[model samples]
Target: MSFEASRDKFQAYLTKQGLRVTNQRLAIFDAAFAQKEHFTAEQLLDKARAIDDSVSRATVYRTLPLMTESQILREVDIGSGEKFYLPASGTNSQVAQVVCVDCDKIFEISAPFMEWYGSTVSLKLGLKPITQRLQVSAQCIAQRQTGLCPHRVAK
Candidate 1:
């Protein structure tokens, strides 16, 4: 989505929620949208702070939940046990990720069949499904052979 459209949608959501569209919130939103990959709240804070030093960690943390609730951001668990945020537009109705336990690399898979199955189940249960995520953990041979995974942080 264009920056202006995202900003307008967020502003409208904030107004509907009876919340003020503070500068800090806008900064956080812009920073998040600028990131092309999934990011943790701390990563978002760093990016936001880089854009505007006035942006605080507290503000970013506070705004993240609001953004998720507003459907502007979606929280993802890539098997790291840490909450990662991604643009909701990037992750539509359903997503599936394979996490390499050794390398901590998350590979997203195209699963239209999964979406269809989920929708069918939701319909059978008489419920509406907003979103669904499936995570599978496995080991990658390359990581085991090299003993180094670029994405994995050394403990």
Candidate 2:
């Protein structure tokens, strides 16, 4: 959905949860939506602080679950201790994540068959599937051969 729509939804969610639309939260939201790559909570704090220096780490940690639960941010775990967050694509499309073992990079690919596969398995067991996910862990062949991860981003 559009940013305005997402903001509206987030406002509604906060209201429904008896939370206020605080400035810090808005800064965190804007910081999150501004990111193009997956980011950790610490990275989010830095961005939010840049927008509003008063933004606190505790608020960032608390608001993350609210954003994810509100369906505006997609949370990803690459089997690493720290989780990553990215803006939700706002589609019902099935997506599969391919995580690079070498550089800890994540690539999202369309996997339309996930719906079909989930449904098929559910039908066999006489159950309904609420959600499904597919993740693949692989190493970069070029990196393996050259001892360099070309996709690695400097921290």
Candidate 3:
């Protein structure tokens, strides 16, 4: 959807949630939707400032946590006091991700991976699983023997 459409929709959503639609929130949503992949608050502030050139770092920092709490944005905690934010699209309550430890590259994986994994372990122990949050990280060294990733190849 277009940025304006998304902004209007999200504004309505926020209103339904009894949240005020501040100018900073709208700017943040625009920046978040326009940006691809995960971004830190500093990165978001840079983009927000590029658009308005008057947006503040403190606004971005304060607003991000509100978005996370409202479920409009998702935060990936890297466990180093660094949290990356992204628009809540593919992410749900059952989302799973594979993050690179060295470079902090996150690849969103199939959510069913969590359920399948939980089922395997629960069946082994003869127990029923209630909820699951399984995240795994791997560092795959690229080799010349294999072909390039389709997403990486130039058009």
Provide the TM-score for each candidate, comma-separated: 0.84, 0.96, 0.70
lDDT of 2 at 6: 86
**What lDDT does candidate 1 reach at residue 74?**
78
Question: Residue 50 in model 1: shift from native, Å?
Answer: 0.6
Q: What is the lDDT of every predicted structure here?
A: 0.81, 0.93, 0.72
Stretches of candidate 2 above 4 Å error?
none
Q: What is the lDDT of residue 48 in candidate 2?
A: 100
Candidates ranked by TM-score, best first? 2, 1, 3
lDDT of 2 at 69: 96
Tens digits of per-residue lDDT, candidate 3, 16-110, equal: 87888877777777788887788888889888877777678888887787777655677887675888888776335677777765456777766
Enumerate residue pairs that collide in model 3: none
lDDT, residue 104, candidate 3: 64
Q: Which residue pairs does candidate 2 place in steric collision? A: none
RMSD list, candidates in order = 2.5, 1.0, 5.2
**Candidate No. with top TM-score:** 2
Residue lDDT tens for model 2, 1-93: 888888888889999999999999999999998898899999999999999999999999999999999999999988889899999878855
In model 3, the runs with Cα more than 4 Å from the true position are: 1-9, 13-20, 90-93, 113-132, 143-155
